[model samples]
Target: MLDSGLKTQLKAYLDMLTQPITLVASLDDSEKSQELRSMLADIAELSDKVSFDDAGSDARTPSFDIVRNGTDVRVTFAGIPGGHEFNSLVLALLQVGGHPSKTAQDVIAQIQDLDGEFLFETYFSLSCQNCPDVVQALNLMSVINPRIKHVAIDGAVFPQEVEARQVMAVPTVFLNGQPFAQGRMSLEQILAMVDTNASARAAEKLKDKAAFDVLVVGGGPAGAAASVYAARKGINTGVVAERFGGQVLDTMAIENFISVPYTEGPKLAAALEQHAKEYDVDIINVQKAEKLIPATTPGGLIEVQLASGASLKAKTVILSTGARWRSMNVPGETEYRNKGVAYCPHCDGPLFKGKRVAVIGGGNSGVEAAIDLAGLVAHVTLIEFDNKLRADAVLQAKLRSMPNVTILTSALTTEVHGDGSKVNGLSYKDRTTDQIHRLELEGIFVQIGLVPNTEWLKDTIALSPRGEIEVNARGETSVPGVFAAGDATTVPYKQIVIAMGEGAKAALSAFDYLIRQVPVDATAAA
Candidate 1:
C-alpha cells in the first residue's frame, strides 16, 4: 500500500507529465499480482496524465506494459517496484512519458552519435541506491537511440541468471553479455565505455607522445585535483584511472566537503571531473595502471604501464588510486551481495527506504552509515564485534540520540542469510553469551574498513604495514618524483576534502621538484 505522504510526492512528480503514460498490469491468480493491479490503479488515480490498463499477458507473471502516448516503450518490470527501487520505476515511467533525460548536452549528443548497435544487460537490486542512477543512464541511452537496447533485470528476482554471471555485487553492467562495468557509474563514464575505442585513444597518445609534466593516477577527488593543479602550471598533464569517480562513485551522500554542505557521491565525483576537464589535462578513463617505472635519472621520464598494453610516460606520478569498502567475507555474503548485502550506505541505502536494515562495524563509517540510513529506512541495527563502540563520542551520541537506531555491541556477524534471489536476514553470535541469533532485515551495509589500491606498488615503493603508500607531509612517496594522495596513501584521514588537499599539495610539490631540480632537456628531459 502506498503511504499518503509518498502518494502526495508522486502526485507532484506526475503533475508535469508531458505525455499520457499508461501502466498496464496483467492480473493473475496470485495475491502479488492482484495487489500490483490495485497499486497500479491507485497510482493512475494520482493524475489525469497517468492512466492504468488491465492486460492478459502472464509470461513474467504480473508484468506491466508501460506505454507512452499510446505507443509502447520497451521498459518492463518483472516484480513489484517497491522499497528502494521505487525511484527506478518512477524514473523509467518519466523517461517513457517524454521527460528529458538528466544528462549533459555533450553526453546526449554522443549517445545519439553512436555508430553500432550494442546490447546492455544491467543487473541490479531493488534496494540499491546506486543501481537506479546506472539504470536510468542506460535507459536514457536506449530511449534516445534506436541502436542501443538496455535491459535492466532485478538480481533478486532472477538469481539463476545472476549466479550464472558470477555477480558478487549490484550495478554490474554487462555490455553484450560481458561484464562491462561494476559498481556505481555516471552518465559521462558509461558514455566513455560505450561510445568509442577508448583504449585506442589512450594508445595513440602513448605513441611518440610528449612526456607529461605530471601524471595523476586514480580518478577520485585527489587525482582530479592533482590533474587540474598540474595543468594550471602550463605544462603537459595526463591522468590515467580505471574509473574517474573511484570510491566516490561507491559513496552515496557527502555532507562534508568544506564549501559544499551537502552532495551525493556521483554528483561530487562528476563535479571533480568537470572542474578538472576545464584545465588542459588529458584524461584517460576505463584503464588501469599495471606497473609504475621510475625514471633512470632525477629528471628522466617515468614510465607507467597499463593493462591495455599502453604505456604512459610522465615526469612525475601522483598516486590517488583510492580504496574500496571492506567485505565481511562470510558465507552467503558474496552470493547475495548485491541482492541484499551492500557496502556503500550512501549508494544503496535508499533502496531499503522504510525497510529494516543493519550496519556492520562500530567505527565512524558504520556509525555514520547508520545515522544516514536511519533517516530513510524504517529501522537501523548497528552490529559490532567489539564490546565498545569505536566511533567518536559525538557520533556515538548522535547515533544514541536517534529513536530508530539499536546498537548491538559484542556481536560477531556469522553469516548473511538470504534466499537465492535476495537477502532476507542475517545471523550473528553474541560475544558475551556466545548465543547465535538471526536478524530479519532487507539489507546489510558493511563498513568495517577500507582496503587500499596499493598492492601493485608494494614491491616498487615504500609501503606501510597496511599496504598504503608511505608519504611525507608534502605528499611525496619514498621514490623520487613519485607522490601519493587520498585513501591509498598514509594520509591521516580518508575524507574527500582531505584527499583534495593532499592532491593539491602533491601537485605543487611535483612542480617544485621540476623547476628547482629536474632538467627538461637532459637525460631524455633531465
Candidate 2:
C-alpha cells in the first residue's frame, strides 16, 4: 500500500512514538478494505511500538482507529486517509502515540476540561484544501480528551451517507447528530462554539492586555508582512484575526508568489504565521473586530472594539481586513447555502460527483471552476451576465474543449431552486432574448468576484464609492494614525505580492508618522 520511500519516511515518524499504539480497523471483503488492511500491515511492520488489530465490528467498513495503549484516547478515520488527509492521519498516529503537540498550553487545558460526551463527525473530500485543518483539529481534540470523540468520514467513499445527510459541501461537521458547522473552522473557532463561556473568558483576558505600537487587524499576507516588519523594529507588535490565514486559506494554487515556483495557500499561510512568530509578534486568532475608535487626542491610543466585547488599544492600527467571495443575492441563495450552493470548487466539487451542476459568472474564477468541475460532475452549465467571456484566452479555449460543458452568455441568475432539502435547479434570464429559463442541476458554484471586508468601518473613516478604505500612496488614511492596505483599501490589483508590498509600506508609514508627530489638536489629526 505504501511505496518503499514512503515506508522509510513513515518509519521515521513512527519512531517518535513514546508509547505503544494500535490500529484497530473494521473491514469487509471489499477492495478498499483489502487496501486499507495492507496499509495497516505495512505501518505496523515499521515500528515495534505499533500494532494492528481487527475492530470486530461490521460498521463503517474500511475504517480504522488510532488508539493509545492502556488509555481511551483515540481518533477514527472512516476511509482511506490519503491525499490532503495524509497529514491528518500522520498527526493522529503521532498524537495518539503520546507525541507532544505544538498547540498552546492554555488551549490544551481547555480541551481537556470540556465536559459531557461530544460526538463529532466531519464529512470531507480528499481534494478539499480546507478539510485537513478541520479533520486534524478534531483529531487532536479527540486525542486530548477521550470524551470528545471525533470521526473523519470521507464523503466520496460513502455516497449513501453523504446523500442521507444532504451534505453538499466538504468539511461539513455534525455534532451529536446535528449540523454544527459547514466550512473551514479552526480549533479555536470550534472551542468557541462548544464552550459556552469561552467568549466571555477570552474577552476578560483581552481587556486587561497592554497597548501595542503596531497592531495589525488582519492575518493575511498583508497583515503578516506588517507584523514582521514592525516586530523587527524592536516595537510591541500584535496581530488579531478571525483566522490567521484570511482568504488565502481558501485558495487552492498560488504560482504568482515571487521566487516560489508553486505552493498551496494553506502551506504558504502556515509559513507566513511561522515567520511572524519568529520575531516578537503576538498572534491572537479567531477574534473579529466589530468597531474602530480613533484617538481622542494626538499621540494618544487608538482603540479597536471586538465582537467579544473586548477592546484593544494601539498607537497605530493597520487595517488589512481582506476580501471575501461575493455571493449572488438572489432568492433561495442564503436558505440553501451549503445545502447545494457553494463558492469553493476546490473544496466542494467532489461532493457533486456524477451530478449536474451550474457555474455562475464568466470571469477567471467561474471559468476555472467549470473546467475543474467538468472532470467530476456529469455536466456543467456555465452562466454569465456579460455578452462575452472575460476569462483568459487559454482558459476559455480549454473550457470550450470540454465536451460536457454548456456556456450561456448575457444571462443573469435570478433565483436558486431547491426541493426544501437541497438544490434541484436554478432560474436565469437571457439579456438578448428577454426569455427566462430554468436549468436542472444539483449544485450551484458562485464565482463572481470579491467584496471588500470594510463594512465595519463605513462611518469611522473616509471610504471610496465602492466601499473600499480610501488611502494615499503612503498608505495613510483620513485618520492620521489609522492606515489601511491590501484588498480592503482602494489599491488597484488584488494580488498576494502586491498586498505584501502594501502592508510593509503601511507599517513603515505608520512608524514614520509616529516619529514625526506633534501634540496637535485632535481635530487636526482627524
Candidate 3:
C-alpha cells in the first residue's frame, strides 16, 4: 500500500540519517508478517544508510529492534507499524540515528528527577495522527530517564492486549498497566502524572477562604499569559483552571502561532505551562469555577466559587475560559465520535490515510480542514450547505488545486451513517437538485464553528447573543474589576497570539485597578 509519491517522500526523510541503522524484525509465518516485512524492505531499499532483516522466528508477537552506530539505543515497536504509523517509524529511526531530542531542558530536568521503575505501555492505531505525538514524547522521556521505559504497541496488531485493557481509542498511555492518559498529552503532563511527589503539591485541599492580588480563571493560552504578567509585577497571583492548556490540547498542528514555524498541540501546551511556571504564579490545574461574584464595594474582594466547594477572594479577576468545537447534531454523529467522526483534522486526519473521508461545512475552517486532510487521506469530499464557499479566495484556489479533493456546494448534510462500531458513509442533499447523495467514507470531520465557554457567567457579566463574554478594548468586562480574554470573549479574532496580547492587557488593567485602591490600614491612618 506504499504509494510511489510517499516512497519518494520517505526516501528524502531517510536520506537525512547521519548514521547507519538496522531494523531487526522477529516475525512468524503469516500474511500480515509477510506484508510487514515487505514494507520494511521497501523502506530499507530507499537509503543506503538503512537496512532491515528478519531475526528468525519468535513465539511472541512480532517485534522490531532499531540499532544505530554499533550501540543498541533500545528503540522498538511491539507490532507492525502501518497506516499513519509509518511516519512514527521513520521518526524513531531518525532519533536513533543520533538526532538530538528537542525537548526543553526544564522538562528534561523534571523527568530526571522522577524516580521509579515506570513502564510506559502506549497503545495506538496505525492511522491516528495524534498517536505519534504522544509516542514521540514518551520515547524521548524514555531516552532521558533510564527509570522510564516505553513501548509503542500497535493496538490493531495486538487484539488480545486491546481487549484486556478495554481500549477504545488511540494514544492511550498505561502507566504500570493502569490507564494514565487517554489522548494526546504533553511531556510535562505525562511527567506530572509520573512524579507522585510532584502531583502531591496540587492535591492539597484548596482553602475555603483564600486571597490574592489577582486570580485568573481558565488555564488556556490567555490564562497562562495573564498569570505570568500579573506575577511579574511582584503581586500575589493565582490561577484556577478547569484544565491547563485549554483547547490547545486538542489542536494537533500549529503553524500560525507566529515565529514558531511548526508545533503540535501537546508540545505547545507543555511549553506554555513551563513558561508560566517560571514565575511565582500559583497555578491550580484541573479545577472548574462554579460561580463568579463581583464585589459590591470598590477594592472589595471578588469572590470566585470553585467546583471543589472552595471560595477564593481576589482584588481582580481575569476570565480566559476557552471555547470548544461545534458539533453537527446529526444522527450517529455522537455515537461515532472517535470511532470515525472527529473534529480536529490535524489530530485525527492521518488515521484516515488511504481511506475516503468527508468534510462537513464550507467556511474557512471547513475548507482549511479539507486542504489539510487532502495531503494525508486517500481522497477528500467537502460538503457545504451554502451556494458559495465562505473561505478566502486563496484557500479556495489552493483546495481546488488538489487532485484528490472534491467540493460539493449547496449540499446539506442530512445524517451520518455508521457501522455498529465505526463510521461507514455520509448522507447529504443537493439544494438545487433536491436530490440526496450518499458517499462511503471512513471518517467525517465537522468544522462548522465554535461555542464560547461563557454559560456559567450568565447574568453576572455582559455576553453577546452567541454567549461570548463582552469586553472592551482594554479587556475589561461589563463587571468592574473583572476582565476577559481569549476564545470566551468578544475578541474579533480567536488566535493564540491575539489571546496572549489580550491577556497581557487584562493583567495590566487589573494592576492599574489594584494600585488605585486605598488600603484599609491607610484609610484608618487618614
Candidate 4:
C-alpha cells in the first residue's frame, strides 16, 4: 500500500525528471526487482504528463515517443538501459535537464536559441554489437540540447518501419526526415550533418539555384571514372547519386581490382571520389534521379530530373547505373541484412575472418564468392535450391579441394535467426530428406545474382531480355546521343576493369558525336 503523501512526492519527482532533472539509482540483489518497479512507476508518471495514455505494462522500460511543445523531439532507447545504457540515460537526463558540459553546453546553447526544430532518427541492428557507441554519443548530445532529439530503433525488431526507411545497413542515421549518414559514423560527422541540415534550411529561405553539365546518374567505378575523365576534359561534369560509393561501397576488400592489390570498398570509393573532385567534378550526395527525358529540341540533349524537383540539361548523357543484388525475400532476411544477412561476400567476408558463413545460391557468382570467402572465413556452407553448382568445372574442382567449403545441394534457406542486429544462425530445409536443420554461422551472404538498374530505361531505350541496355561495340546505345556502359549495359563480363574500359569508350564516342557537330577547323583542333 502507498501513502498519499509519498505518491504526491513521486509525481513531483517524475515531473522534475521529465523536465531536465537527473536521477541515478542502483540496486542490490534483494531490492533489484522492487527498485526496478519503482523506477518504472516514475517513468509512467512522466508518460502521463506527456499524454501517453497507453504507457503500457512496462513503463519503467525504455520506449519511444514524440513530445511537442511548439517544438518536436523524438526520443527512443535501445537495449534494457540497465548496464552501459543506465549511465547513458543519466547523462541524457542531465543534458535534457538544461545543464551540460562545456562543449555540449555551447552547442546546445546555439541550438535552443534557434527558431526551428530538428528531428532525427537513428536505426541500428542489435546484432551489430558496436551500435551502442552511437546511441551513447547521441544520448550525450540530447543531454546538452533538448532541441536535438533522436529516435533509436532496432532494425530487426521493426520490419515495417525499417522497410519504409529502406534501411539496408545498421547504424544508419537520418536528420530532418532525410538519410544523413550510414554505417559507423564519428561524433563529429553526426554533428556536421546537423550543421549541414541547418544551413540547407537557411539556404532554402534564400532561394538559390545551381546548374551543371554532363550529369552522371551513378557513382560506381564506371561513373566515378567517367566523372574524372569528363571533368578533366573541361566539361561541367557533375555526379548525382543516392550514395557516393554506389554498390561497391559495401565491399570488404578487392584483391582482383587491378592496380590495387588489396583495398576495402569504402576506402576505394573515397579515393575515387576524391580524385574526381580534385578535377572539379560536382558530386551531389543523397540525390536520386527520378526521370530522364529527351530534350525538346531533339539535338541529342537530355533532361535529368531529380527526386527533389531539381533538373539539369546535358548535351550528352552516360548511363552507368549498376545492378542491385538479388534477395531471398524470406521472413528474417530483411531484418538481418548486413547484420548476418549479406549480399556480397567479396564486400563483407573479411570482417568474418575465421568465423563461419553461409553462401545462398549455386550459380557462378555464388560458387565464386563461396570460394573466395572460404579462404578468409573459417567455414563456408553453400546452400543451393538446385541439385548442382552451375560453376565451371575447374572452379568446382577448386572449391571441392578447399577443406573449409561445404556444399548443400537441393536446399533452401527457410529462416534466418539472430537477436536483432546480426545473424547468429539460419535454418534450411533439405529437399532430399524433407528435414529442416539449423546451422550456426556468423554471417550469410546472398550471391544469387545481379539485377540491372535498367528498368527505367525500358521505354526510353532498347533493352535486352535480361533488362541490360543494348549497346554497340563503341558503347553507343540505341539512342543517338546516349551511351551505356558497365553492368547496366549488355557487357559480357561485370568487372571493375571492364567497366572502366567501357566508360572510356563511351566518352570517346560522345566526343566523336560532339566533334561532328562543330566546324571543321574547331573539330580538327579538338
Candidate topping lDDT: 2
- Tens digits of per-residue lDDT, candidate 3, 431-500, equal 9999989999999999898899888899899999989998999899998899988999999767788889
The whole-model lDDT of each prediction reads 0.82, 0.91, 0.82, 0.68
Is candidate 1 or 4 superior in lDDT?
Answer: 1
Worst 10 residues of 1 by lDDT: 517-526
lDDT of 1: 0.82
Give the clash count for each candidate. Answer: 6, 0, 1, 11
Give per-model TM-scores: 0.67, 0.83, 0.62, 0.62
TM-score of 4: 0.62
Candidate 3 clashes: the total is: 1
Q: Distance (Å) between predicted and true CA of 327, model 1? A: 2.0
Sort by lDDT, top down from the best: 2, 1, 3, 4
lDDT of 1 by residue, 35-136 (tens): 778778888999898888886474666667566765535466656777666787888778877888756585677788889978887777766767877887
lDDT of 3: 0.82
Cα lDDT of candidate 4 equals 0.68
lDDT of 2 by residue, 1-526 (tens): 9999999999999999999999999999999999999999999999999999976473899899888888999899999999989999999999999999999999999999899999999998776777899999999999998899999999878999999998867789999999999878889999999998889999999988999988999999999999998888888999999999888887666766789967877899999999999996989888999999999877899999999999899999999998887989898786567668887786678889999999998999899999999999999999999999999999999999999999999999999998755799999999999899999999999989778898999899999887889999999999979988898999987788999999999999988888777645754766
